[model samples]
Target: MAVKSKSVASKIVLTALVLVAIFPIFWVFLNSFKQLVDIVSTTPKFIFTPTLDNYIYVLGRDNVQHGLFNSIIIAGLSVLIGAVLGIPAAYAVARYPNRFSDDIQFFVLSLRFLPPVAVAIPLIAIWLDLGLYDTRTALVITYTLLTMSTIIWLAIPAFSRVPREIEEAAIVDGYGPYAVFFKVALPVAAKSLIGAVIFSFILVWNEFLIALMLTTSDAKTLPIIASEFTLLGRNVPWGILNASVIVLSLPPLIFVGVMSGFINSALKKKD
Candidate 1:
């Protein structure tokens, strides 16, 4: 009975920790449903009626359809580039763990540490000179570099965790290196690869800094559009702002929830 009590206590504490971690997301969601008068109210308004007015206003905007389209296009293209580049690169690194491969992994990770703002200046200049400024291609190339580093980082582990003996056995049975990689290694690591790609998609989708600077009116993203609310007058359209934010936030949230479930199921199946 005493041991059972200890386990219960532990569960309670863990539950509290999880709630703390998720509180900010909960706060955003709760406020998104509240009316503007209640959103920043001095007193908490948890008991108030919820409204979809904010969401309707944001989604109903003129350029929003275009922005949404652009976001989907850029994010999808970025994921494709990351998968193409990172998968082979990671497979090579895992298959041959030489100093060069290790250095390559290290170099890929180094890209993350570089500030976006610092890179954006030169990138903007180069894009302008190349006549690629404010174009979808610019977004694609930058997002490729932005997302692929992390995707490669995640892919390397998935590849390395697969036993080399499995690949060797397949190769010995007449399968080529590529066949062994695709037929054996990738099938097993599909869950991790899928999870990593989903994560990369979320990162590119939510990215603001590069998108803000790289894209003007022609190719502005959701995040960039969200920032436009702040430039409004004092009596701002609160409903529209909150509505826009909620919609903007939904894609990544749903992506994580759906992909996480699949990943969990995949891991269970593997077990």
Candidate 2:
């Protein structure tokens, strides 16, 4: 009886935690469909008429569309470039351990520890000198610092998990170091690498501070555009703001949903 009671209590705690976590997102989602009056009403309206005006208003703007496109381009390119560079670097660190290897890994990890403002301040001057300011190219290059560090840090363990024996077997079959990495280690670690890429993508996608400092107009991201809504003093446009929140959230949600199968496989493999 005591064991059963404990199990029930644990389940109750877990369910409560889940509800608490989900409630804010659910509240925003609910409000996105509401009109201004319904959203700000003293009493919550549970059964008010829903409208697509919020969505239409938010999506109709040209800046929102451009910001969305810039976000996609910047996030996608950063992840792609970071993966190409960081994966090989990770494999090298995992497979080839020297006196400096640990130091190198730590240095890479240390980049992530620095606050965004610290990195952005110096980068802003450097970018200005190079005449790359307010360009997507500038953002992509800057964002690689974020994406590459994350990928390398996460992928080191993933690459380490590739069996040494399999690599040796590939060598016996006439595979060179590069071939072994490409053929044996990479294929084995693909699922875990997918997880790492997804994480890096989300990180770069949601990044706002550095982006805000670097870009003025042509390279503004969705988060930057969403922030503009909050600057409206009295009116606030809660409905449009909530609508923008939903819009901002959709890409990451869709990316995760599309990659759910690989994510599940990766988890199962880890298990």
Candidate 3:
């Protein structure tokens, strides 16, 4: 009876947490289908005629498309760059556990806690001096700092989880370090690496502060573009804004669904 009660309690907690996480997103989705009048009504209306005008207007804008394209490019490239650099660095730190490695790990982890404004303030000055401000390249570089730090830190545990014996055996079999990493260590740690990639992609996709400061027009992202709906005039276009939010959120949702198995598997495995 106690066990059953505990199980029920756990389920209730999980359900509540899920609802809390999903409610805002569901509200925004509902707003997206509503008319401007319906959205801004004094009281929330559960029953209302849905329309496609909000979506139509949001999608027809060239800035929306441009911002989305930039978001995709920036997030995708940031994750790619993060993976390329982080995987090797993580492997090194895991392989060599010493003072130097400890220092590197501390530095990498420290980046995660650093405030965005702290990094963004100096980055703006440096970017301006280098003539890279307001460019995709600048955003890409700035976002790499965000994604790469996360990748390197998260990937450490994944690499550490890989058995050293397997790597040693591969080396004895005449496989080079590169081959062992690609064939043996990587395969063993692929689940965690995939998790890192997924997380990094989401973080980069939703990042706004640096993009807002650095990008004026050319490199503006979906979040930046969505935010502009509020800044257009005194009255916020809630319907159009919600439509943009829904559109912007779809890719991350789809990516997570596609990678759910990997994420679940990684979570189940001991680190």
Candidate 4:
């Protein structure tokens, strides 16, 4: 009877915690249906007619659709570049585990500590001088700079999870080092790679400062578009602004859900 009571108490606490975490998302969803006037009104109107005008307003904008496409391309390429560079570095670090690997790891993490404005000043000037400003390439390169190290960091522990003896046994069977990596290590660490790709994509997609400085028109992204929500002369379309943000952010939220599934499956393996 005591144990049953404890279990029920625990369930209640867990349910409460879950509700608390989800309340903010519920609030945003409700607010998305509200007009700007209703949104600003002090009294909460829980049961009102839902409208789609905010969505229409957002979709009617000139470059919002195009900017979403640009955001996807830039984020996709960043994840690709990060994966290409990060995996090899992680493999070497896992396989080598020496001073050179340690130094490189430190250098990569150090990039995170530097303030954004400090880096942007020189980066923008350099890109402008080279005629690379306002281009997709600038975003890709900057994102790679920001995201690759994180992938490597995530991948290293997963790589280490593979038994060294298993790799040596592959080597003894006449497979080359590269073959062992592709055939042996990669399969074991597949979940981590997926996690890294999702994380890197999210990082580049939400990147604001560098995208603001480097790209103006040809490669503007959703973050840049979201910044233009307020018109100086007109009252801010708070409803449409929030709706655009909600829509623009949906893809990343979906990615995170998919990642959660991967994590669940990976944990099921228990190896």
Candidate 5:
């Protein structure tokens, strides 16, 4: 009886936690379909006529479609560059343990721990001086600081778990160092590497501060564009704001759904 009671209480607690997490998203989704007047009402209306006007305005006005495109370009390129640089560095750190290797690994991990605001001032100044501000390339390169750190840290453990014997055997079988790394070690660590890349892409996709500071118009990302909806002084456009939130949230939601299979496969392989 006690075990059953405990189990029931645990389930109640879990359900409560889930509702707390989901209520905000549910509220936003509901508001996204409401009219401006309906949204701003003192007493919230449970039942109302839904309209597509908010979404229409969000899509049609302010070149939001362009901002979405810029977000994709910046995030994709940043993760790609970060993965390329971080993978080899991680492999080296994992495979070869020396004073220099340990130091390099520590430095990389330390950068991730540092707050972005600490460096944002000087970083923006340098970007302005170098004429790289407000460019996609600049965002991609700047974002690598965090993305590279993520990949290096995550990929290190993945590479470390790969059997050294497998690498040596591949080397003995007439495979060069590069070939062994690309074929043997990489395949074994591919799942973890993919996870690192996917997570970094998601992180960069939702990034606001650096994107806001470094970009103004030409390269403004979706998050920045979402914040722009409130620039119209006194009255906050709740409908449009909700609509933008819904739109901004869709890509990440879709990505997580799509990547569910990949993550599951990685887990299955480990088991």
Candidate 6:
């Protein structure tokens, strides 16, 4: 009876926590469909006529479209570049424990720990010096630092969890180092690696500080454009802003939803 009681209580707690976490997102989603007056109403009308005007207004802007495109390009390229560089480095750190490996891992982690402003200040100067400021190329390269560190940190454990015996067996079958990594270790760690890449993608996608500091027009991201909605002074377009927020959130959510199948299959394999 006590165990059953405990289970019920735990489930109740988890349900409450889930509701708490999702309530803000649900609220925003609801408001996105509302008229501006409905959204700003103090009474918080639960029943109102829904309109597509908010989405229409938000999406019709050229800047919003360009910012969306820039976000996709920058995040995708940064994650791709980071995965190519960091995966190999992670494999090395996991498989070969040299004297410097720990130091290298620590250094990578320390980069993540530093405040964004600290890193952005120096990068701003460097990009300006190279005449690369306010360019998508600059954002991609700058975001690579964030993505690479994330990939290396997360992928180290994934690679470490891969069985060494499988790698050794591949070696016995006359596989070269590169071949073993590509065929054996990589396949085994594909699930976790995908997660690392997705996380890196999301990090770069939602990143506002560095993007704000570095970009003016050509390289502005979705988050930057979202913030621009607030510059309308006192009568902030709450419905339109919420609509933009929903749009900003769609890509990562879709990416995760798509990749969920792969993650499930990986789990089934491990089981």
Q: Pick the candidate with the highest TM-score.
A: 2
Q: Mind sharing the TM-score for model 3?
A: 0.87
How high is the lDDT of residue 166 in model 1?
83
Better TM-score candidate (3, 5): 5
Local distance difference test, per candidate? 0.84, 0.91, 0.89, 0.83, 0.87, 0.91
Rate residue 62 of model 4 by lDDT: 77
Residues 80-167 of candidate 4 have per-residue lDDT tens digits of 9899989888888989878788787788788889898888879999999999998888888888887797888778867887878899
lDDT digits (tens) for residues 1-271 of candidate 6: 9999999999999999999998889999999999988988889788999999999988999999999999989999999999999999999999989999989999999998899999889989999999999999999998999999999998998898898999999999999999999999999999889888997888899899999999988899999999999886788889999999999998888787646764564456553
**Model 6 / residue 188 / CA error / Å:** 1.2
**In model 5, which regions exceed 4 Å deviation?**
1-6, 41-47, 257-271
> Lowest summed-lDDT stretch of 10 residues in model 4?
262-271
Provide the TM-score for each candidate, comma-separated: 0.85, 0.90, 0.87, 0.86, 0.87, 0.89
Residue pairs with backbone overlap in model 3: none
Off by over 4 Å in 4: 1-20, 258-271
Error of 1 at 115 (Å): 1.3
lDDT of 3 by residue, 224-246 (tens): 99988888678888899899989
How well does model 5 score by local distance difference test? 0.87
Per residue, candidate 1 scores C-alpha lDDT tens digits across 1-271 of: 9999999999999999999998767777787788888887898777879888777766777778778889999999989998988888888888878879868988998999999999888989999999999988899998899778988888887887787788888989999888988899999878778888888999999999999989888888878888787666788776577667777888888876767765575456453
Instruction: Pick out the ten consecutive residues of candidate 2 with the lowest summed lDDT.
Output: 262-271
lDDT of 1: 0.84
Q: What is the C-alpha RMSD of each candidate to the true structure, in Å?
A: 3.5, 2.6, 3.1, 3.0, 2.9, 3.2
Q: So what's the TM-score on candidate 5?
A: 0.87
Whole-model alpha-carbon lDDT for candidate 6: 0.91
